[model samples]
Target: MSKPLEQNFVELLEQHQNIVHKVCRLYTNNYDAHNDLFQEITIQLWKAFPKFRGDSKFSTWMYRVGLNTAITLYRKSKRTINTQQFDTVQFKISAEEYDSTEEDQLKLLYNAVHQLNDIEKALVFLYLEDKNYKEISETMGITEVNARVKMNRVKTKLRTILNP
Candidate 1:
């Protein structure tokens, strides 16, 4: 990488570190794998950085790339490795106080989402991250209607898992 591009790369990482970390955490529950995937995603982003235009917000573009990398990179294996050694990292939330019930519910939701198929998990990830149908469709290269339908199915599946 050229000096200017290297500086830009570091700046991008500094600005969007959370996005990459979140993708790694969600895609690979194991810390070692998560770190490896994180590195790989960063490399992928750097490689693809040249194609990025300033038309969209940087976070939006980063989300698209990171989500795509997470989904495609980790979809090969279906086995759940033990994550006992992985430390539960805290996220930066605006609230001054933490709600254990809400945290537990979120954990339960992620656990159930973990049980979904690759495609379903992708949809769930985008939905949980508050991505709109259009963005999700663009990222996944599917129709907006398809994104809505998939999200609806994922919600139903999650409800069943959480309730049952």
Candidate 2:
């Protein structure tokens, strides 16, 4: 007797669902949009799981599918994102833990990240995840050299955005 493949998929997805959440967070600003994108990414992962061979890690495959789904939907969806100050809905904090300076800086950084194009944002997200150039190239379907070049450019862009 063997455990079913669907069960295995469920278990693996449960273990790695945080990756999907991170993707959703990077790609979507609003809570509603985050949940929506999360659901879509999970569905895409489940649909593609059957074809998954163990050549690479499950988490690696999830990154590719998650990023592709997010990038594709992000490009197709035409919607306006309203920027707001003190967006309690998006950044909830308890009264005790509230620090205006830290919160403001975090908000500023997020705004800077949101300014980047989809591919650049993806590159930044992968880099933050501590992925190497080779891993990023594999996840992004680009050569390692390309990933390194894009990452350096993105870093410079982020510095300019943050400082200026």
Candidate 3:
């Protein structure tokens, strides 16, 4: 890659790296898996960057690429699941951000989210990020109605998981 293009890529990636982190956290079970998925997502984003037309916001494009990489390229072995304690998992949230009760609730929510299938997790991630149905459909390559339906189902599933 040319220096200017490389520089631009670095700048954009630095600016929107949180999107990658969010996807990685949702997709992976532990710290090592999170780091691996983050690297893989970054590589995929770099490879796809040249083809990124300036049509959508860079963050929007990043979400599409990052989510696709998480769903398709970074598959985990179903037989060898490694669970980590919620406290050990480092996400964007910090210890001081919430009170103990809120922290416990957040942990429960993340645990419930981790139980969802890949597609369902992606839908929940986008929904939590405030992506509209159109943006969710564009990112996931599903119809808007399908996205809505899936999101509703995911919410119902989450409620059940939390309540149970």
Candidate 4:
């Protein structure tokens, strides 16, 4: 990491911090593990920065990198499962009263998503992020039909969890 590249990466991180944080929170429920994953993703993104071409938008690239980093982290560490299962605290909706209920609903949705597998989490995250089936498929390396099917399955899973 050259000085200028390092500086530029810091700037990039600042600009896209929300995407990384959102992905991290969606992928893991444990605060410590979430922070670790966020750091790991940041490192991975920085390591892979030089290879990034001007082919696609930076955010799209970051999304791909973020998802891949998270999935890879899950694959590499087996401890997160037990830790995640033990800590099931429900996250409160912290927005203003006007939209707080909606925020709480979204929080519950993400909580359910947190219980899902990595691939499933990625699917639900993409869906919530408003990525169409085509883009989700491309980012996830799955077929468009499969993306739609998986997204439908995610919605069904959420409905079951929230309703039951």
Candidate 5:
């Protein structure tokens, strides 16, 4: 890439870097993994930047590419499957009985979301970010109706996971 193009890319990335960070957070649990995934996403973006035309907003395009990269990596990587055994019978602290703060609920929600597959995580992330179905569909290259249906399914799955 030309210096001007490189500089422009840097500026745009710097401006919208939080998008990448959010993607990293959704995909990774630890700080090192988060940084590595962010770097990989940045590298992928840099490699594809030369082919970018202004057909869509840069941010929207970034989401598509970032999500695709994450989904691909997630499919290929061999993460350690949890090996510890857990007791089936546990103490009961019901939501109504326990005075949980908003942050506590947020943490629980994030933990549940972390258990989702990459594609489901992308959908949930986009939905949580308040993106409309049209935007989600465009970002994921799915039909708007499909996006809505998938999101509904994801919501139901989240409810089950969080509740169970």
Candidate 6:
């Protein structure tokens, strides 16, 4: 990469690194794995960045590449590892305002999400990020209708996991 392109990539990546982090969190089991996957995604993004025409927003393009990397290159055998505990302050919630019940529920939700297949997890991640069906379809290279159908099935699967 040229100096100017390198600088541009660094600036844009810094601005939208959270998308990579979110994808990393959804796909990996432990902190080490998360870091590894994040690194891999960043590397993949850097390699693919030169091909990125200004057809979509940088963040949107980042999502497509990030998801593809996670699904295709970074997937590993599922492991039943305990989820990492996070401080409430990290999430910007006051310690005093924290509810253990809600926290437990959140953990359960993540646990369920962690159990989903790679493709299902990608769907859930996009859905949680408020990406519409069209964007999800575009990101996953599925038809819009298939994205909607898969999302509904993912939702149903999550509900079953939570309620059963």
Query: Would you estimate the TM-scores of all the predictions?
Result: 0.84, 0.85, 0.91, 0.80, 0.85, 0.87
**Runs in model 6 lying further than 4 Å from the true structure:** 74-98
- What lDDT does candidate 3 reach at residue 57? 81
Candidate 1, residue 146: Cα displacement in angstroms equals: 0.8
Q: Least lDDT summed over 10 consecutive residues: which range in candidate 1? A: 78-87
Per-residue lDDT tens digits for candidate 1, residues 1-164, read: 68998898789889888888877767777667878988988988898888888677677778778878877776556565333222275557654565777767767777787777767877777777798899888877799999998899888988999999
- Cα lDDT tens digits for candidate 3, 1-164: 89999999999999999999999888777777789989999999999999999888888889999998888854545432344467776656576877889878878888888888888989999989999999999888899999999999999999999998
Worst 10 residues of 6 by lDDT: 84-93
Candidate 3: the clashing residue pairs are none
> In candidate 2, how many Å is residue 9 off?
1.1
Off by over 4 Å in 2: 1-3, 80-105
TM-score of 1: 0.84
lDDT of each: 0.77, 0.84, 0.86, 0.79, 0.82, 0.84
* Cα lDDT tens digits for candidate 5, 1-164: 58999999999999988889888777766667778989999999999999999788898989998889877887788573221112221223454654557547866777788777778889999888888999999999999999999999999999999898
User: Which order, best to worst by TM-score?
Assistant: 3, 6, 5, 2, 1, 4
* Per-residue C-alpha lDDT of model 4 across residues 1-164, encoded as one tens digit per residue: 68998888899889988889878876676778788989999989988999988576677788889999988877887645532442254334443543767757756665677778888988888787888888888788889999998888888988898899
Misplaced by over 4 Å in model 3 are: 74-83, 91-94
Cα RMSD (Å) per model? Answer: 2.7, 3.1, 1.8, 3.6, 7.2, 2.6
lDDT of 2 by residue, 39-131 (tens): 999889888888899878898899999999999997788654454343544433465585788778878877888888889989998898899
Instruction: Give the candidate number with the greatest lDDT.
Output: 3
Q: Order of all candidates by lDDT, from best down to worst?
A: 3, 2, 6, 5, 4, 1
- Model 6: per-residue lDDT, tens digit, 58-96? 887899899888887644544444456543214434666
Alpha carbon deviation, residue 33, candidate 6 (Å): 1.0
- lDDT pick, better of 1 and 4: 4
